[model samples]
Target: EFARAPGTSDYAHNTFVDFGGVTAKNVRLTANSNWGGMFNQYGLSEVRFFSIPVFAREPSPDSGTTDVDVDVTLSFRAGREAAKHDVYLSTDEQAVIDGTADVTTVTEASHGPLPLDLGTTYYWKINEVNEVETTTTWQGDIWNFTTHEYFVVDDFEDYNDYPPDEIWSTWIDGYGILTNGATVGYPAPDWNQDEHYVETAIVHGGEQAMPFFYDNTGSAAYSEGERTFAVPQDWTKHGIKALTLYFHGDPNNAAEQMYVKLNGSKVTYDGDAANLTQTAWQPWNIDLVGFTGVNLSNVTELSIGLERIGAAGGKGVVYFDDIRLYPLFSAVVGTFSIHPWTGDGDSGISSSKTYTHTGKFTGEGTDGEPFFAGNGVYFERDTNRSGTSWTLTGAANVFGTTNPVTVADDSAALARSFFYGDEDNNHPVLTLMGLLPNTEYVTTFYTVGFGGAGLRFVDITPGDNLGYPTRVDQNGVGSGSGQLIKHTYTATSTEMSFMFDALKTGDSWHHYAFSNEAVSPNLGSN
Candidate 1:
């Protein structure tokens, strides 16, 4: 119940009450009495409702903005009745009142010099508060923003070509068979334009979107759109690991085949390829960790092609807009190895393998749970306490970020050897349950703890196993990378085990033990 004098004696005009942080879908004001009358008839001047701070302004990242700097300050306008403001920031969209308001400032409000995760989305809101009002808090609507890497592949805002008229492969849906090119420019209209016309256009909050056509009618086996783009920067040096974009598909059109080409190598979609949903405009993200072999740096050209393989009538059209590239986060890391071999008829045959995996390593202790891998290999923590795993901390070197792969330079640049000990005792362990009996197998791992300041590879888990003296082949530098310790051997029995125990011995440890982790297990054809 907000109260006021009800009516003004000065021209009877300035009578109002301020409600700080309250909102409703519908508001009904029931007046009891005023200065003009006792109960029935009352004089009221004006009423106003606000879902947000009445005068909120100057959002740091800006509403619906992208490519925001990692270290950004968030600020907003001062409320009309606000004595102070409660500000909140979060990566989670549905978060509510977690007690973690980034900052609450007087007069308008500002928070930061705050650090942000790279390649991530953030949601923030402001709530106005008044010390003297009956209601001191009025929460506002949530506003969102996203942050990107220092490097930007393309925003699609400025293309020297103006409109990519010649880029779309229009001949496919009989689009090329006709004449005036396939893909066309979509410039969003301001007013209520013709909905039936395909060109009234829906842009991704931009001036234009390049849309392609697909007929799949007569002689139209497939309806797809393809266009090539010349990458502007050397994203490889910038640690690019993910690709993102905005897409639009007609609700009337069903699932279709969608594929993308990076430097000519076909990289399949993470989702179902046969069912590319063409609904409202949405963002799609693709992680590059699983991409076996793709050169991200010095990337000259990229081609995007979509085919309507399962459309009911054989043809349909789709729209794609706003493509972006990103670096990895601190939580995601990849460590891998390359094996080039020659023998058996193909002497020059060479191939490489990567050991980077995306999975959670919780501290479960020795009595924790265990699960089997796709290869029927059962694995568990080195001990019962979840504390046995490697520690995540700032590095002694400058290559990585507090030992985070996704936030570091690249997979190879990670320094994984930060530990709490110099002793050879306590270490993280993992056992592989399914290995062939007496089978020849070679395993290579970039073990960090073993070769610390003065520690030997033998100091850690060398010839490590469930039980028994296993065959110890060799331990040495891999590629120009002297840090990667390659250990090979033959399986004496079925179950194989490994461990990370640099800190257990209580031996003198430094910032150098255990840089990062990369493992490779190869069972030669027997």
Candidate 2:
């Protein structure tokens, strides 16, 4: 049933009608009477209906997204007639759905960059509200997102050159103490009061890094920079397993054992000794489980220090940044190397190299079996080249400098044989399996060139981080020994890989043996 207007016109005109607050699913219309001017009884064309919009739609992060930042703003499209929005967020899904969850009513369509915890899934919803409308509330659908597992303990980004905010002011170093060898910042050339002390050029992830200088040349045995928390920090949250920090060293830095102290418990570095000399930024992931005698839940202090490894003390500058806490990653957090070795047979061992070899004589010497006398990590011979290139399947032994070297038994079998391939068609790849993600490893490779074969260049590229394409040059004058090349990388996946490309046409590549070892925060096994 409906009402009709009395007036009539040549063109079609719209009619207005009020239902006075009625709720129905269907509506019908019929002709009560016809105007006198019309030829027939009555006529009807079409009819349409409209109402106020209810629910909030279109979530910003959508839903079920993982690895979201802890400080993420929840936004959505508000209902058409909604004058205000009620935001509800929580870790419990049932709470958000029941309307009893924590609610924040706002005029805007967006909620927050909410205060959230790491490694957690949060459920959220919005209830659109308009008090004047007959239907005052419209409940929204439940949405959820997960935050990242890791949290930043310190990035050094908050520190500045100003007073109180200065990096050295917070990170107390041995600048004024004689017993400690650490000087946190650089000395300004002029008496400029507002001089920048933190290292700006060589940084790990941010605009600045702490330039901790160590001078153990005098009476000091070690250098350290410590920071005391204003309030006790609880490291036992978010299922955290490791504490990771990035350190960049100068080439002139003295080789010292880097260590971090939790509260007062010390955990010395287990990586290569030469890492302090390499100019690249290296990650030192310390396992929290290893910090014995410290209350992880109530962490009060943290210290980064370098201790003297030998009788003689050395000194240099090392930059530190991005000290963070990390949980075990399901799918590798960073890149890592698989191979590890003991001795450096070559020189110029970068932070990448765990060990290098300098010998020239090959597995076979001038005679049938010459004396193989050198302290090195030896690999078992792989009779088949194809199998060895794909998988290093042989027993490896690490020999210290003090260990006695045998002539025929040890040196003759020292892994000098490798897969020979054409540069254009075939390239060798070495793969190491069963590696742990978020762990750091050191890989070493032994390569040698034939006599008078000119300077052969080969591109050594790791599958993941540490760096890509480390170029190795082999001078083929006549040395029987091979050069040891090593690389350091964190494992981003369960497997580690390497690709060898011989840049020269005629020159070939030979690998006798290799080794792998986990350095920082060693879990005993990979």
Q: What is the C-alpha lDDT profile of model 1 across 244-267, one tens digit per residue?
A: 665556534445455565655666
Q: What is the lDDT of residue 340 in candidate 2?
A: 19
Worst 10 residues of 2 by lDDT: 393-402
The runs of at least 3 residues in candidate 1 whose Cα sits more than 4 Å from the true structure, single-residue gaps closed, are 1-155, 159-201, 216-232, 272-278, 289-292, 308-313, 329-526
Say which candidate scores most in lDDT: 2
How many steric clashes does model 2 contain? 29
Which digits, one per residue and each the tens of the lDDT, describe model 2 over residues 1-526? 3335444655454665676657455787665556654665665554566665568988888899998887788889889889999999988899999988999999998887676677788999999988998878887899999999678888888877668998888889987688899988775623365347777656655577788998888888999999999999887765677888877666677899889999989999877767776544567778888899899999999999998878888999888888888764222123322221223333223334232112222323232222232443333333342222236322122221222222122333443334455546455666776677887777755444344333465555577632224434443222443444667667778777777666666544555555566665435432
Question: What are the TM-scores, per candidate, against the unseen true structure?
Answer: 0.31, 0.52
